[model samples]
Target: MNILLAVLTSAIAVGGTLIGSWSTYLFQRRTAERAEAVNREERLRQERLAAFSTYAAAVTELKRGLITLWFRRRRALRDQDTREELQAAQLDSDRLGAAAEAAAFRLRLVADDPGLRPLMTAISTHLGAISHAADRQAVIAIEARFEEAVTAFIDAAAARVQ
Candidate 1:
């Protein structure tokens, strides 16, 4: 009887150990899953932040190029060599605009907010206007509008990542 009692106690202890181990495994698995999910979200946030910043920088570069080309066009109207230089500047501006558009597309892919699309579109329109602006006054006015749209986008992006 004593032997049978010892065997039963040992079996109970073993079963309890197995249950404890299984519970611990399940708990650890859940914790790991949660951690993984948090990590994924953080990574996505970083990606979106990068995309937004890149797009912003590209837009700024394009704007600067357009402003430069506008001034060049005004000054180079009478000079043959300056006209060639202005043409080169225009080409560079075009390239910058294309790059900015590509960056915007990337931002669209990573942006979780649907509202940002319209803001981006508005910024693009302003940029287009700036590129084709005939005078310094028009460029200045369009630049102000572009800056506002950019600020709105930045604010929206900041809210999203937080």
Candidate 2:
């Protein structure tokens, strides 16, 4: 009878140890999964932030280039030397436009907010209008709208990333 009692006690202890170990393993696995999820979210936020900022900078540069090209082309009509300057400005404008387009594509890929796409496109359309603006007043008007579109995009992006 004593030997049987001893065997039963040992079996109970072994069973208890197994239960404890299993519980601990489950807890640790859950914690690790939570941590991994948080890390993934942070990484996505960072990528979105980088892509948005890059796109904004690229578009702003393109806007400036377009305005400069517009003014230079106007001057070229009156001055011979300005024609050479106009060509250089045209080249610069083309490069900036390409960079802005590439940045737009990157932004589109990373952007979670659906509203941002139209704002991005609006800025592009604004820049195009500026390139063909009939007068300084027209360019100035488009510039204001361009700024508004950019600001809207930024606000939407900020809300999304947070």
Candidate 3:
């Protein structure tokens, strides 16, 4: 009887140790998975923030170039020297526009928000229209629209990143 009891006790002890070890392993695995998920979310948020910042800076620079181009075009009709300036302005504007478009595409790729596309398009459309404006007043009006679009985009992006 004593021998039988000792063997039974040993078996139960072994079974309990295995069960405890398995439970600990499961708990640790779950904790590691949760940590990994949190880290991934943080990394995505950082990427989105960087993309949004780059897009904003590129768009702002493009807006400045487009406005300069508008003034240069207006002056080119009356001044011979302004024609050269206008050509330079045109090149700058083209380069800036391409940069802004690239930034927008990057932002679009990183952003999960669907509404951002139209806002981004609106800004680009308005910025493009500035150079085609009939007068300074028209350019100013388009600039205002561009600012509004940018504001909308920034607000939306801010919400998404948070």
Candidate 4:
């Protein structure tokens, strides 16, 4: 009877040890999974921030190119050299515009907020109108709109990153 009691005690101790080990493993796995999920979210947030900044920078560059083109066209010089220079500027402006569009598309892909698309469209429309501005006043008005759009985008991006 004593031998049987000893065996029973030993079996209970082994079973308790197994239960404790299993519970510890489950708890550790859950903790690890939670940590991994947090890390992944952080990484995605960082990627979105980078995409927003890149899109903003690209838009700024394209705006600068368009303004330059507008000024060059306004000069209305018809000499061969002037015409060549204007053509080159136009090509450069086109390239910058394409780059800005590509950046905007990338931003769209990563943006978490649904409102960003309309803001982006507004910016693009303002940018397109800049070259067609008839006078300094028109340009100024378009520029104001452009600046507002840019500010709105920055604000939205800041909120998202936070």
TM-score of each model, paired residue for residue: 0.91, 0.90, 0.87, 0.89
Prediction 3 TM-score vs. true: 0.87
Tens-place lDDT per residue, model 1, 1-162, is 999999999999999999999999999999999999999999999999999899989998998988888778777875644667888998999899899989988988888468888888888789778757877788889999999999998898888888
Winner on TM-score between 1 and 3 is: 1
Off by over 4 Å in 4: 76-81
Ranking by lDDT: 2, 4, 3, 1
Candidate scoring better on lDDT of 1 and 2: 2
In model 3, the Cα lDDT at residue 155 comes to: 91
| Residue 73 error, candidate 3, Å | 2.2
A best-first ranking of the candidates according to their TM-score comes to 1, 2, 4, 3
Model 3 clash count equals 0
lDDT value, residue 106 of candidate 1 = 91
Error of 2 at 95 (Å): 1.6
For every candidate structure, what is the RMSD over all alpha carbons to the true structure, in angstroms?
1.7, 1.7, 2.0, 1.9
Give the runs in model 3 whose Cα sits over 4 Å from its true position. Answer: 80-84
Runs in model 2 lying further than 4 Å from the true structure? 80-82
Encode model 4's per-residue lDDT on 73-153: one tens digit a residue. 877453434876788889999999899988888887888478787888889999999978988899889989999999999
